[model samples]
Target: MEQFYLHLLVLLVLSILLRFLIAPGHAPEEPPLVSSRIPFIGHLIGLARYGNRYYVRLSAQSQLPAITINIFRQKIYLIYSPGLLAAAQRHAKYISFEPFAALAIRRAAGIKGNGPIVSSSSEKGRSSFDKQMKDAVHSVLLGEAMVGITRASVAAIKKSVDDLRSTEVDLLTWCRHVLTMATTDSIYGPMNPYRNREAEAAIWEFDSGLGKLTLNFAQRFIAREAYQAREKLVKRLLEYFEKCGYINASSFVQRRLEVERKAGATLEDIARLETLMVLPLLSNSAPSTFWVLFDIFSRLDLLEEIRKEIVQNALQFKPCDDSMGKPKQMCTLNMNNIRDKCPLLVATWQETLRLRANTASVRFVSKDTKLNDTYLLKANSIVQTPANVLNVDPNIWGPDAHLYNPRRFLDTRASPGAGGDRKRDRKWNGFMTFGASPWTCPGRHFATAQILALVSLLVMKFDISPVAGDWVSPRINHRSMALAISIPAEGLMVNVVTRKEVKGIDWEFQMMEGKA
Candidate 1:
């Protein structure tokens, strides 16, 4: 019996060796493949160690424009070259984002089966379901609709800031609470699912569990909490729709629902998808706001500079008649003025995004295609463009790329051309904070406006300082896989006091035309 078992083990080892020996090699024109110590599982181990930073590490090692990572039977091509990325994006039909987007929607939104919710059908070869949805989102985030939403969001933010009676608070927690309330209220009106604190807590719970859910893990084993939270939020959303709660919602919310319904999505699917929408609208923005505050406050010079800019651009004081024998000062911030006039603030925002954003833009190769006239991306392969790689590339961003320099964006100079005429172009490029090409985020304008409004309000009305003697930036919590923006590992505790300059003043925010 022992001899028989030894013989069987020997045969198994021989068979595995033979299989590897007989495997086909990459074509001469294809990108070089990184060899693994153990077939199939080695790359997985590497990914586990590196997470989203895996591609950049690989790129640095290989110094290749593209590289193929084979895990089991799947192939993922990482495109590091800007030229190759542009080509891949331009060839939309052959290498598409929709298929991957559909899969993400199903996994993240908890939609069952391969539904028509993500399907594409061309009428006169014109519009697909994905295209229509994109168009709807774009339309709703522009002009009057955007203004109305921004106005509502600013109001919520103002109320939250004004009601801060406590001397000490956690910065991240405060930003999350205020930003979440503002974002949801603006989008969903009075029937916002996140309006309830329990429901809001559930949303965060669901977010923390996305990794298990995405892997299709068993709820009985690991994802029970996430599953329960998702179910609760979905039920609330479905109830809201059933009761016509969308009647008073923003056009963005109403139009999104209309588009989904027209695409033949059931109420249950819509509810699940709405839960997914909440992440992008709230999760990322809150952390981003926190980071913006941290960066500014950590450096006293930067904070003072920003405050001066805001005062010069957005802040205005109107003398009000007082009935209590004292004159009152009413302060109003025009968001339009802030957005247009505050170059340093805008630069700071951009720098923060570049430094902190770790989102990777992913797409599916629909057909066999050549990238950069070299690497052949086989059909059904995954491709990724990690924004961090682009944002930190020294060749593109100069020698000080890794440093957080807000003035990096402000140094645009036009060189002298023939006949002493100034050149039209600027040298700095490769800023992909919100992504690029067709897959760029549609809600970027609204998010930028919302964040700026909140940050501007906080700086103008409140004095904030760390409770601890000195400010130390917290390590990023990479464990929160559901969030695209990097979350701090811990909450920042700070003392907040109303700015004496803005005391006895009523604060208001207005969305001016042609601003965002």
Candidate 2:
């Protein structure tokens, strides 16, 4: 009897082990609509190689409006139909991002607390970040913020121009530094680390590890080093804060302390604030600036049009000599003036952004929900609005969707598809460069203004073009192993020359005429 019992036990143990090895539990309860067989791994073989195209293929293959994907041991439901996806986005309260493992988030940001924004509905504060964090960021927006920011940004632009006067600098490489200076100065003020290249490098090193949720062995190894780098920088920031009288109870530190007192959050919370302040100001601004310059460098016809506008506007902004024979800071053009007059300048940028932006928007489902007849997403599903797919749709954007056409935006009245108001359009199919919903990027207006300023400055000052016959635009490179949320393909490398060198340049040259 004992021998027989042992034999049965061995069989049971082997069965359990086999199940685990096969990862049967990892399988989705609802099998994906679109199925593929590439041995042990499913679509992963193609996914790793092709990235976005893999999803595009799955969308095409599924035949259904939505498709299910098994990736990273999770069941992902991708909604391909723009109309259906938009409906899902409208009712986004049902889905949630809380299903993501804490370990995955920690691996990305090197810190915890369900990210900087804690939702009230969540048991562990795993609610949507669109409301809380985004609100906090835009809370301090004011005309005063613009004044300092514009001044610093303009100063940085002038400095970069001076530095690159004799050199054939990569516009993207140097413009990032200029943006870093402007943004950091505006946020951190006196303790700005713009001049400290080492500090800037460290910050980027730490930022690199953010946004991946996978914690596989290789990922963990990279995360370990990233965490170390994060710790080093966090320590430095803390020390800097202390040196700025934080330890001695200055206003800034005291304000933070007061928040801790009210909310009972810890020193970790303060650290989070530091990270939030730094990142929001750095990442997007740099890329936006780079793309504007890249567009100008690659397209000479577009560049000349923008140049003409800038020179005209610059001439208008050139103040008549005051009684003291001093030029005023600005020539009195306001926001309304900018919108009404320089449509081409504005349209060119909008067109470029549409071409380069990854998608329309992304929203985390706040609860488990169903969209349409097909998808039954679990509580914490990530439902992305297929902006890239929609933006390039031949049916919606017409046959010329792939071509770069600034006139599309310039002649909105003549546009067959001016669409509708943002919300209504978003409900169907719309552009999502700044996302949608309450969590839409608050700094988008500011970002647009700054990018326009940078572009205007470059156009006014430089004659930019691609490197001769080698001037073909660089293919957007998104296939790198980097897992950051807003990863941009490597920027287009191009050459820029001063406006004077161009043979048939059109410019009023207001700044040159009266240098105080």
Candidate 3:
């Protein structure tokens, strides 16, 4: 029996070696291959070791416009050339993003089988449900709809800021709590699920374990926390719907429910779908706010400059009488004017996104087709463009691409001959923080509004300092790859003091029209 087992092992090893030796080589028209040392499993190991950074490294090392990495039987074509990315977007029929979207909805939302959530057919062969959802989101997040949501969000944020009791607090946690409350209250109405602190905490717990959960690993052991959190949050969501939570919610939420119900989704299925919605609405803005704050506050000069910009753009004064019959001053900060008038603040926000965003835009090839009239792509293969690769490319972003320069988006004439006028335009084209069309984030406008409101209020009302004398940027939690936005490994400890200039002054926030 021992000899038989040894013989079987030897035969299996021989088979693997033979397979590697006779592996099919890449065709002349196909993208250049990144050679892997071990057969089948080498690229997977590399990905496991480096995470998304692996693709950026490969793009940097390879001379070709694209490279193909083989993981077991799957072929992932990683496009580095902007022209090829554009070509892929144009040829939307052959290389489709919907299949991947469907897979994500299934895995993350725990929806079983072919549901009506995905459109059956369309001109682009994409999901109609997705298009409806996108339309619904856009309708509610722009024009008058946007104004109403923004007004409500800014008010909620101001109230939370005014209610800050602790001088010293965890900056990330505080942002998450306040922003979660404000955003949810605005979108989900007064019956927001996150109003309960424990429920909000559970949602975050589920978010943290999302990578494992989506992979459908053994949930009882590997992703127990995520599993438990999902159950708790789902139960709450069902209750919210059962209690007619949709009555006062925004049109976006109402339309989503209407579509799902028409598709024969049960209360439980809708509850699961709502959990998916919570990710974009809640998870992204908090960390983005955290990174922006970290970048600005770490540099005192930048912080002071931004504060000045905020005051210049948004601050309005009111005259009043004090308790002792002395003249007193009060200020109201207008959120409507900030996005356009404050270039430095906008630049800081853009730079923070470029530095921290590491997600890839993924698509699956539905049919065999050629990309860029050069490379022949096989059917049923994956195609991807990692934003980190494009954001850090020296060709696209100049020599200082790797560094986090907050003023990158600002038009400074310090170097007149250095393409200063065109830097912002070029950078905008290369930046995929919100992704490209067809698959762009639907709630981007709302997310931007919420983030601006939160950050603007914090910088105006509070003076923040790190607990440690020197500030260290937290590492990105690469394990949470399932998330669209980067999550920090840990929260920052900071001391917050109310700004003296704004002390004893009644403060108010009003949302104005236009961007930001």
Candidate 4:
């Protein structure tokens, strides 16, 4: 017993000594300021509550390329600068996506029969899935299906205005319901579940599942809600597909199945489909709508300018019909052309996302990688590229970085992010909101287009103004923060009145306008 005890004591001492040896040390000339409280829990509290402030404090203290913190039992390296982020992506193998994949796998889908969500066993499967999603976005949905969606959304918007005599409804909830209807019906097929209370309940159940899946605990164990919702939604979707003759013809489902077969991966199709909806629909749709409406309410001058522009340009395309008629053909606005003509609305949306986004990205380092001559990262170290820090940093964006100014993007002479002159061939270093590498957002165009459409129309129709007294800012919630994309961290609430008609015929005919 004495001998065994002696051996255990020696082993414990050796382990302690080894940890001390491997642990990071401060330089003789300069030491890191405000590292995580515990070895890995650095800035956890600060980040959870006051995310922007946490980075500001840390960056002010030290110009270190990267700092380490433990987030949910994982050692995450926080990369503050664009240069370091560049290095990390270029040497991606050294920084694997396996850790991030573990979370996606256990909570999102399941333990991959093949490999991680980000890493595919075969490049062909990746290419196939990418092509499928891309085709689906630009194909029938944006083409033939968009006409119905636009009509429905426009109709909903008009009704929403009429329903609001109080002029103080929760815009966030209103936007969520409207966009959910517009998006799901247009792309996924005509199940019109938004109006049906039971169907809406199912959606909430599905959303609850998604909420659970996103939790830190869920990542460690299993996403039970997500899985259960998957079964229910899949049954519904399969029935829809069969009725629509899409079971065999649909490219999206076909591609998903192919990818699974090729990579030997497993995921409930409906769950993955719903997860996809959360990003494109929820991330930008509600928050972007709120911010744009918020801006219109707060800034009279800017709102007037945009409103006039939308009236002059978009309304001119399709003349109002005298007789009651179903829209045979929807007026299509060339988004690229709109961007060329009206720069203000685009800039407004960009600035809103910059200010609202709280987190950067979840980048997993590959095993055994050297970041630079000064630093080295071991295999499977999680890296966080805090774009929020980079976006609002005064040094980078000038002294008035935090100030709300839409002109920064509109002023072509100025750089897009920094509010300076436009730089040719802009790269994805400073702007990491859409993310980087093989895992970048596919719905970027869709989100941008939807935001522009909703905002452009609303600005044209309504002369929004802020309610009396101090403004009610949104309640910040971490889950609402964009883990990989910029979204409202919590329910963003605002009060504003719609643009009342000043004795003029609205866009639609008299009866149609009344119906609206």
What is candidate 2's lDDT per residue for 1-516, written digit by digit as tens? 999999999988885575356532322433254545642366678756765556556655765556565544444666656666556756745653334433444444445454333323454444333334333445434333444454455555555555555346655567777777666655556665334786676666665555332343454565665555566666766666556634442232344445444444445545544553565556666766777676666777877777677546543543355467764433332333343467887877776666766542434555666666445666444565545555555555567978888776754523223554543343225455665554355566566656666677566667666554456555554443332122455555456666564323222212111110
Q: Point out where model 4 deviates above 4 Å.
A: 1-34, 39-57, 70-74, 92-99, 102-106, 110-168, 192-235, 238-254, 257-280, 311-320, 324-337, 370-374, 412-428, 437-439, 465-470, 479-516
Model 4's alpha-carbon lDDT is 0.54
Which lDDT values do the candidates have, in the order given?
Answer: 0.78, 0.54, 0.78, 0.54
Candidate 2 stretches with Cα past 4 Å from truth are 1-32, 62-64, 96-105, 112-134, 141-155, 211-220, 245-261, 311-336, 359-368, 372-375, 378-380, 411-428, 467-469, 480-493, 501-516
Worst 10 residues of 2 by lDDT: 507-516
RMSD of 1: 4.0
| Pick by lDDT: 3 or 4, better one | 3
**Model 1 Cα lDDT, one tens digit per residue, 318-403:** 98867776878788888888878888998898889888877777788888898667678888888877777877877667799899
Clashes of each: 0, 9, 2, 18
Off by over 4 Å in 3: 1-25, 113-115, 118-126, 321-327, 412-425, 513-516
Question: What tens-digit string does per-residue lDDT give for candidate 3 at 1-516?
Answer: 999999999988996786566555567788888877777777778777877877877887896778898876678899987667767878888888767776677676666655566434443534566777666666776546666777787788889888985388888899898888887888899788767988888889988777777787677578888888888888989999999998998776887888778666778878988887767777878888888888888888988998899888888888988778888887877766777678788788888888888788888998878887898877888998888788777877789988988676676413223665565545665677888655677678777777877788788887788887679877777766655567788877899888877787777776545534
Give the range where candidate 4 is weakest over 10 consecutive residues by summed lDDT: 507-516
Model 1 off-target regions past 4 Å?
1-25, 113-115, 118-127, 322-326, 412-429
Candidate 4 local lDDT, residue 459: 59
Positional deviation of residue 240's Cα in model 2 after best superposition, in angstroms: 2.5
Cα lDDT over the full model 1: 0.78
Q: lDDT tens string, model 4, 1-516? A: 999999999988885575466455433322122445544344567765664456656766677767765454445567776666667778865564544443553444333344423346666755565555456555534454344444454454455544444356566677766666555544443443234554444554455355456563643346565556555555555455446533433333344445444544434443344344434454456666776677656777877777666555545445454357533322333444344567777778777766665656776765656555555665556666776777776545557878888776665423345644334113234555666654455555555655666666555555544344445565654443444333444554445544454222343311122111
